[model samples]
Target: MPTKELSPTELHLWNIVENNPEKIAKMSIVKLSQYAHVSTATIVRTMQKMGYGGYTSYRESLKIRNNSNSTFNVLNEADDKIRSVITKNEIEMNNTLHNLSYSTIEDSISMTKQAKIVYIFARGLSESIAEEIMVKLQLTGKYCEFHSDPNIIRTIASKIKKDALAIFITLNGETDELVAAAQKLSKNDIPVLTFTTNKAGKILAFSTLSFIGYKSKTNYFPEYEVRSRLPLQIMTRIFCDAYSVRANFYKSN
Candidate 1:
């Protein structure tokens, strides 16, 4: 576990868990709160401060690690690392699915189907994900454009038609310029959608509809990835499928 300065309540909970890891796997949030002598809200806030989205995610990760054959071997062997990543990604996907709002996904698919054209905005590694969306959407016969350059994105935002839809992909939703441009499109009455981290952030606030995806631990060295974005990739694929289903369903009607 990563070490950081902890508050008294957090420390108490940590000590109990550290001494009896097995007990937590079967414990609910309410049970854990009672065992720690803390309120459920405090437990939730403590988890968030420790980098988890919520209690469920925190507990799931702990359970996954506990089940692993050898935690220390995770970094010692390539095979172990691969296994570890696969397990963690599976957990993340389940967490994302459990938390997803079906209505929001339906709204996003409906918006895409109704749009005359689609604009995709992403940068760096996320640009590939955006490109995939463009390709899949275009295959459905919807006109699409992808933008990575800030100037071009802003230019398109200013001139986008009201019937068009904009989809932005940002892992952290901390890209100030992209958020600004998306907000502009919202102001123009052009529906804006986004794919972002599970935790709430700026871009999500203005999106006409948004899909939350799994967020893995941050990689300090860009060249060597310690966590995989497979969960997010699966989410994009699911979104494409949903778009196709909605389009065909309406067409048959």
Candidate 2:
């Protein structure tokens, strides 16, 4: 991850409090929410994420351990900031994400115009997104390959036609493997497009086009991916629309 992803709230919240063990021991969901910028419910969820039942208990555990924490608090807070800044209030974050998602279709259409063979290399959660695109683009009758197997992703990436197009999806964007894969694709002169959560991340330097996704809504009370998933879904629909338009043009031939 980029050094800038660190948040001061995480710094203070995790900082060693040798002065008053009670503050760490007695921290509340409300106080953590105030600092973390996520909902109070999310703070509890954050505690749960750290293996505690809830926020108050999580803080108490910190008291037990003498406070040696790491960077995940910063990561979660950054997720909060992304949601706050990028998502629209009272709007179906899904709709907002769909609006942004069309750009992916636009990107696909542009690539299809040039690449006789298009290779999609993604893994993990991105594999789902890639497969959806592969099916949709196949309707155009253009040759498209979606590979999530790490070996094939790298192997096919190395062997792609020099003029082909490569699209990568890695939300974190700073992941070492994806970065290396992108570097390989770039060397072969294959245009690389990427979708990621952090636009300022290292992947942007290599990607000709990129999109950042953020969560729209959250109800930590019940547990969900409503905020982040909405934006991703939006991208999916948008890409479908753009590709549909391009597919029509191809049909004219």
Candidate 3:
């Protein structure tokens, strides 16, 4: 399933469903919301974000049974575990590709080609993807500024010109610094482009164009702060390649 990074509350609700699927399937939306200690709206929104029509649809989906073995089974053999990991990654990439919009990509490339300057901002693991974009654009003779620091991103956002373009690479897309920067740039009428896993993220509201990517809902390491960056990597590769083609074509003309 194509998934997204969930908020703490949403994650808590998901945990309940994951642990007690039959129980959730039996409960009404109001009952589930009360049991989960969240509002009915939260329940509906979380279900919708998970690709369900609403709470009713999600509950119905839970009722459908699959007799196959659990994908999270602890494999006895090392090779089996390796294959499992590979299979999961393949699924992740496939879902992300399926979610991509060709027209949105073409629009992003066109905006990049027309911008006076391209400002890229990212934090944590997302910085690598932003750097890749910067390097690719720079190689095509486009002037790009890449910032990984939160303070610098906010500062640049405030001072950036109207003709400049801003791209934000974030997994959850709810980072305070990044959202603040996006809001500032948006208010100034700067073109903002964002790549994120969260379709309901605040940054999307400020974005002139947004690319949504799929993230695995499974948290393999619940104790650690690790999450897969595969979706972002795949989307970045596509965007950079398309932008490069357009940039080269414009130069040739």
Report the number of the highest-lDDT candidate.
3
Lowest summed lDDT window (length 10), candidate 1: 71-80
Q: Better model by TM-score, 2 or 3?
A: 3
Off by over 4 Å in 2: 1-108, 216-227, 249-253
RMSD per candidate (Å) reads 14.0, 19.1, 14.7
Tell me the TM-score of model 2: 0.53
Instruction: Kindly give the number of clashing pairs for every candidate.
Output: 0, 8, 0
lDDT of 3 by residue, 1-253 (tens): 4344677788788778778887887776556757998754455556656776456556555655544332222112222233466767776777777777654565567667767899999999888889998998888888999998878888889999866789999999999999999999878767788899899999988886778887877768889767898889988889998887766633544
- Which residue ranges in model 1 land beyond 4 Å of their true spot? 1-83, 218-227, 249-253
lDDT tens per residue, model 1, 110-179: 5676567888999777888899999988888889999999888878789888767789888777787788
Return the TM-score for each candidate structure: 0.61, 0.53, 0.65
Cα miss at 112, model 2 (Å)?
A: 2.3
Model 2 C-alpha lDDT per residue in residues 1-253, reported as the tens digit of each score? 1213334543343343324457645544434445445433233323333445444445545655875552122111122233543344324443335334332334345555555776776767667888887787777776788877777666776777655667776756776767777878766545676766665778766664555665333444456322244454455556556667756733444
Q: What is the alpha-carbon lDDT of model 3 when measured against the actual structure? A: 0.76
lDDT of 2: 0.55
The candidate maximizing TM-score is 3
